[model samples]
Target: MTDILVSEIMNRLNSLFPSVSSELNSINDYTFLIAVLLSAQTKDKRVNIVTKELFKVASTPVQMLELGLDKLKEYIKTIGLYNNKANNIINLSKILIEQYNAEVPLDRDQLELLPGIGRKSANVILNKICNAPYIAVDTHVARVSKRLEFTKNTKVNKIEEDLYKVIPSEYHTIASNLLVMHGRYTCTAKNPKCSKCILKDICNSRNKYF
Candidate 1:
């Protein structure tokens, strides 16, 4: 049953949105990591807005550290939790320079060691930058997974485990992007667009309050 459902979701998502990658506008690892950190509890569009100004001045760990927290905060103040985010970015930058030779660590464990970087953030970095098969369960992924009856578990970790088990190995990375886009545009939190959704027939949450 899980396999059948997974196949259906994969087929529909691929047909609807064929391309799936990080929508962040960044040219380097440092900027990418900063954008990911800023993305927590924030929208990608807003992250792009803040990162554009921040990256223009400081796109490297050394440059960021030299900018100092106060100035950094000033640049990213538009983002939610800007204070904490700025602190984390600064500290993470310092650690990067001291430990990874100013490179975003590819290893999940090493990446998680940095401030503000949790499992989801690490997974996104690995999947997007390293081309690894990791499904990062943000709010969208978790909500959509349960609504689709892909997992009974509400916990983020369990949802991730269920998805990994049900999703085909080839579609893991694409699945993350597809699910995220689906949640953002179709299976929305407030009012889902089920009428226009291609997966409405199979969607367990169709016609139900989102």
Candidate 2:
């Protein structure tokens, strides 16, 4: 996409969702990291619901370890992949306490080394917590990018790379959040509100309803 088109897209999305940010509730950085970890393949609203009780008992790495796997599972059982997620949470908390001085690492590589954190999760932590310039690609971001013709790539990593080439660095921090919010509420998987979209005129998707 051209710079002018990218700017117009960004401007419209920012206007539509001006205060777009992470919806996952957390008490602190540690809880935020844990919340993001649990959000894989699950909605942020669901993760927030689970974390409401979970964080009350265990908000830190040490406290999370004390919560133990069984109790942790009980707290997050409503979320998908709870069993594995519980295990990863407990294990990652242990690593944080032991290796990182009970702190979530700012480094993407170190964050990725954790049991549940992959590139996408690591990118989120880095961008939101550490103020690093990285576009964390989730299903929403990928869908919006393709629909906008920012990229034809299907793989998350390649799409991310393509987005970096098209979108300026100054907009990287809010890019994913804007796209995610748009895809979640407007350009949804089915029956997208094309008629109401500001970018409907520029949208290249063949599936535009209008």
Best by the lDDT measure: 2
**Residue-by-residue lDDT tens digits, candidate 2, 60-160:** 99999888999999999999999999999999999998999999888988999999999999998888886778999999999989999899999999999
lDDT of each: 0.89, 0.90
lDDT of 1 by residue, 44-125 (tens): 9999988878888999999999999999999999999999999999899989999999999999999888999999999999
Best by TM-score: 2
Q: What would the TM-score be for candidate 1 when compared with the true structure?
A: 0.96
User: Any runs in candidate 2 off by more than 4 Å, and if so which?
Assistant: none
The window of 10 residues in a row where model 2 has the poorest summed lDDT is 201-210
Error of 2 at 154 (Å): 0.5
Q: Pick out the ten consecutive residues of candidate 1 with the lowest summed lDDT.
A: 201-210
